[model samples]
Target chain A: MSAVGSLVAGSLAFMAPLAPAAIGGLATEYVGALNIALEGLILVGAFSYAAAGSIAGPIVGFAAALLSSAIVAAGADLFSRKAKADPFVVGLGVNMLAPAAASILSQAVFDTKGVAVVAGLQSAMALPGLRYSDVASFAVAAAIIAAIAATPFGTRSRAAGMSRDSLAMAGVDYGRVRGAAYFVSGLACGATGAALAASVGAWVPNMSAGRGWIALVAVYLGGKRLGGTVAAVAMFSLLLSAAAAAQAVVELPAELLLSIPYFTAALVVIVGARGSARRSARRRAP
Target chain B: MRPGFRTRFHIETIHDAGGTKAAVRLVAALASAATLAALAAAFLSSEPSSALRAFFLAPFGTEAAFLSTLELAAPLAVCALGVIVSFRAGHYSLGGEGQAYAGSFAAALAAPVLYEALGPASVPLSILIGASAGALVAAPSAIGKRLAGADVLLTSILVSQGVIFAVDWAIGGPFRDRSSNLVAMEALPRGALLPRLAPPSTLTAASIVALAACLAAAFYFDRTRSGAAHDLYGRNQRFAELQGFDVARLSWAPIIAAGVLHGAAGAMMALGARGTAIRGMSGGIGWSAIGAALVAGSRPQALPFAAVLFAWLDSGSRQASILSDLPPDAGQAIKAVVILAVSARPAIAALRRRR
Candidate 1:
């Protein structure tokens, strides 16, 4: 394949994991919670799905990943609702806790800390050089979009975040909705792990590879529009692919290349924020 | 959106703070036990008793373990004090990780350069450089929050991650020491290093410095007028602004100061124990500091105990990993659960108060 073709393929590969996460994060974003544990959830999926997939089968692996992540999300939601702690901090707690637990489990079970190869995985279903994960990304994304636009619970989740106390004080079962949002996030993250692991045929520690954070960035940058969120994720994944390409050619430091996504997110925030502020200021002025 | 007790857990119900302290402690202890029990059942079912013993008692089993724990606690306590300061000022900066990494790198790079020109004073000068590096990294968030109303939490993290990546590359690539087999930078000479205060362990005067930082922070928060105003502003922004406090300055100053404190803690790590900057050496010190701060209720006075408790968790985990089959990161899991358990204390109190 040509370099450009390969880059395009890589972009799709990057987008496959991140798209589900960004879509899932929209659920949490709506419910006034940033599920910073998105990364941790993705790792849980990457590890468990692969481990189970190799041992049992893909379907069972997928279920195991989803179940495990849901349990974690449930705990995070409980802490957010009952503990009254900063949900962001709680998210960070879960992020730390997940990997630590996964690593310990891996050590006990697999006897390795670096990578666990999923045995009995047939292959990445590919045609014309595009993997199954790429197609699956779009399928899952469409479902998420349809759910958000058509569901009553989605509207409630959106209302929950509009103010600090409205959802907390509302007559609706907002806790359940918020909890469901977190669970949805977990489910999406599970799909993300399964897709990525299927392509690579191994569960690499830290396999989420900052995609969780990048997904959060995309969700925010998309500004509540599903289409906009997809576009944002595509743009980010393309930039990440381009950066990887550039690192191969350029003399720049590898770490700097790795940081391009985060730096781009920061720039997006600052520029987007300033642009909005300027427009709002003009609208208010004579 | 309301800055609700950024660091301290305010669960007062017209009751004495004293009464709740015991309640919080009891709840915290109970939560830790529950968490450990759960972990044991799920992960350590093979040899739970032995693992628990190493995790709990091994840190104090030997003088070496005890002093090493103290050494680890020094940086954590110093960084936790930084957390308290920023949280008290209503600036929730999660940039400690990047700040500490930047500080360590700066100290390592600057100490060798300044040793010849400044001689013995290079120690302090190198520390100042580390602090400045941290401040430089943190300044954008403070400025963005003050001027543009951009959320500091988001900006600080983004900026921090960028800096961490940059520093990681530099330490691993161009700036790495060519002579050393280890992935570390040039070691600071003897005069630039922190002098050891205790024997048989790497206990240095930096530990005293860490304690002094906590004491001074406690004094400032409890006794000073400026500290009171900062606290009031952090708790209620509109009320503080109406009361004629400089809320804008309050927003920025605390963040910068916290960066400086985190930098100093990083400097202590590089200069005190490692004597050189190593890639990824900052590890989880930043998160651990935040954990300590949260468990301490963001009170400077209580930070030392919180730091030591967490330090024990870390050292004990290592001991367990070495003496038994338990892996190193199991300690991290236990510590995280313990932190969550500790934070639950105030929440339970707050829930009861609400009822």
Candidate 2:
């Protein structure tokens, strides 16, 4: 493959892990409520993938991931809306809780501190023609984005997010819409977690690393638009791929080099946000 | 005209009613407690009685165990104190882990070098070097937030991951100790290590320092003018601003203070662990500190007691595994359950509200 093609392939693979965040962002943009617990949701999904992959098949593992994510998301939503707890705080708590739970489970079941290798799930394959699973994941993400953008529910969801009261006044049950959106977000997160494990062929504790947060950055950079979010993910993935590819040639430590993509993404978002805000202010001024 | 105006006002009243703040506080508290209870139950069932008993009581059963618990809690208490300050100021600095690691790395790098040059005086110097390194690492995130409106949480987390990876690379690569089988740097000289307060136990002078720091923080947070200003800013930034408080300046102070405490904790860990900075030597203490702060509801003075309780549970769990058939991991599961139950009390209350 050409250098560009290899980069693209690597980027696509990297983007697979980010699918959950993009999907969650799409839900928030549509539903008018943010799922602040995306990090926890991802963690739970990852653990569920590991656990279910160990006992049953990948299908069961996938189901477990989706179910676990939904439960966490729903719990977060319920707490935020009904209990009146801060979403951010509760989300942080959930993030802590997920890994601890996963670590304990791994240790109890497999006598491992961080991971468990389940051959059953590892052997799970994609449809024969697809060749690689990442291609399928990217395809699904694109489809979800396209479908959401083209739907009326999506339009209403975005409107609700902008102003819940305004949407409510228009006869939409904003709470119900938000609840549904969170469920969808959880499902997406779970799918991403399972896909990530499947791709790696093993489940490592805290495997999502900071990918969920990275996706959030991508969402911000993408301006919360589906196309833009996908583009941002693609851009970040490509950057990471390039860094990884250059590791052998560069004398720098791989870990420090691995940090380049994250640092670059954060810097780009910061700089871009400031510049755009300034440009808009200039345009608004006489 | 008057009737029409009155009818419009009545309609507006209904709209305003919808905006009435939900009883979220009561719900949050209940949900948290329920989650803790459930987790505790799960953990208790998963382990044998002896393990459960040991997990809960071993740290308090003997002096050595108690001191060891304190040794562990000291660093966590210091780190959590920093988290509480940052969180109170509405700044989520998740980079404590990273900052702590940077402090550890600096301490490790400096301990041997400083010991050779300064001889007996290297201990304090190594600590100072570690604190400075931690502060430097944390400064970028603080500046990013203050200058560019960047989210401190994201920046700090990113920086922390980068720093951790860098530290790991340093230990595994250039700084690799040829004599040891484990992946760690060269150990510091005997004089460089913190003086032990108790024989055979890991408790050291660093624990006393940590305790002093906590007491000092309590004074600063409760009685000092700047601390009061931080409290005001934290509770309501807009209100503080309206009251002519320098919310931004006051907020920055706490964040920097947090970095200092986290750095100190890192240094203490290095000293207590005998100079070598092991991977995850902080041992999820940063996260637990956050948990402790949350459990204490950001009351700085109450942190030590909470930290001790958490540390006790942590040590006891390990002891229980040794004494019983249950695995050591069961103890952590129990702790997680306790936290979950405490945090989930509000969710249950919310469910009640819905009904």
Highest lDDT: which candidate?
1
Model 1 chain B: worst 10 consecutive residues (lDDT sum): B1-10
lDDT of each: 0.76, 0.68
Model 1, span B1-355: residue lDDT tens: 2121011233221111233463464346445744674465347646666766777777887787687788889988988887778877777788899999999999999998888898877887888888888888788877776666555666777778888889999898989999988888987798888777676787887778888888898788778988887888777888888988888889789899989988988888888889989998988788888777766666666677778778777776776667666677876787777666655546557645754
Q: Supply the TM-score of chain A against the true chain A for every candidate structure.
A: 0.89, 0.90
Total backbone collisions for each predicted model: 0, 30
Show the colliding residue pairs in model 1.
none
Tens-place lDDT digits, model 2, residues A212-262: 767766666676667677778888878888888778678887988887877
Worst 10 residues of 2 chain A by lDDT: A123-132
What's model 1's TM-score? 0.89
